[model samples]
Target: MDPYLLNAPWVNTLRLVLEVAATVAFALSGVMAAARKRLDAVGVCVVAFVAAFGGGTLRDLLLDQRPFFWIRHTEFVWGILALCIGAMLFMRQRHFEPTERAMLLPDAIGLGLFAAVGVDIATAIGMPPIISVMMGVTTGVFGGVLRDVLCNEVPQAFSDHRPYALCAFAGGWADVALRQVQAPDWAPLVACVVLTAGLRGLAVWRNWELPAWRV
Candidate 1:
């Protein structure tokens, strides 16, 4: 039973659209980041792939979706490749930007979409609500975290005062509550996407951060 289809079909179509936009943004950001790092053509693509798909890969594994979403969506792979090549060929090659300001927008989009999709898959697999929410957050952050580690830096999302992953968690769990109420399936998905993107953008704009432990 396509559990995520509880909403009207139009909602599903909207989600599919949002998901694609998010994926493309993520791919572009990842590809751009790799290029800025001065990675060779091959390294540029490998890093891009890891940054874009790592979270989804982990989420699918946890959900027991063998073969993974990227494997199933082979065009997604081709799209990533096309993006990498285009970025390399056309974009100005620059030294890696540590602050990485441009990445903020795309990363937020990626966070929202991945979190929503994670919730959908988890609910489909009959996982407990809380676990599903955690998976949602994981789906949003793991990719960038791993990408940062590979690039030999602590993830900006974690090291900074900004509420990066926190936003993802909030967005993910929001859907869980909605799921319990049996509200339109797309409500949570749309809510999470808007919330995650807005929260992250607000945090960046306002310099918002979690309260630090006063030792």
Candidate 2:
């Protein structure tokens, strides 16, 4: 067994909490995308499942891990299903419209949590630093990218130019640095979450964007 995978009960508890938070956040973002597209209940569940598991599925594949997360933990799928159903019911009852801005916070939070978890998983598998960081970015952004594509919009991670993946990259490096400094297991996760989400939120609030390139 990998030493990194072995931890105290409280550490496992924290990891579970972070995982649930990230899953719920990404699932909500997917639900919002479905709402914006006026998707039916089936479409909503599909989008939410993709958004919640897409990145982690890819990460597990790249890591060559067995029992993909959703398969290993059936609850994740059930949770997304329940979330989509409830969100759809609530929105329908209230006749509420979901805006792009409404998606931002959840997206940011998901990005941060996924990024941190990605790095942790990669390092646990003894991957190199650069590869681990890249994995972190992939785990953070790919779900949202898939969601946007399914929604028939340009992926915000690519087109919005608001430093989305870059935020994840920075957070990944921060996680690595904290680990190098022998920080507690929870510290790196907390730092990564804060940095990634904070940077994303600030970018949106300040209208910060990368300059568009002329062809």
Best by TM-score: 2
Candidate 2: the clashing residue pairs are none
| Model 2 Cα lDDT, one tens digit per residue, 2-49 | 356467687677777887889998888888888888888898999888
What is the Å distance of residue 43 in model 1 from its true position?
A: 1.2
Question: Against the true structure, whose lDDT is highest?
Answer: 2
For model 2, the superposed segments whose C-alpha errors exceed 4 Å read 1-5
Worst 10 residues of 1 by lDDT: 91-100
Pairs of residues at least 3 apart in sequence or in different chains that clash in candidate 1: none
RMSD of 2: 2.0
Per-residue lDDT tens digits for candidate 1, residues 1-215, read: 34446556886677567666777766665665665567788877877788788887888877778887677679988988898887776755654344568778878877988898888778877899888888888888887777777767677668877798899898988888887887765678888888988898999899997888789
Off by over 4 Å in 1: 1-12, 92-99, 212-215
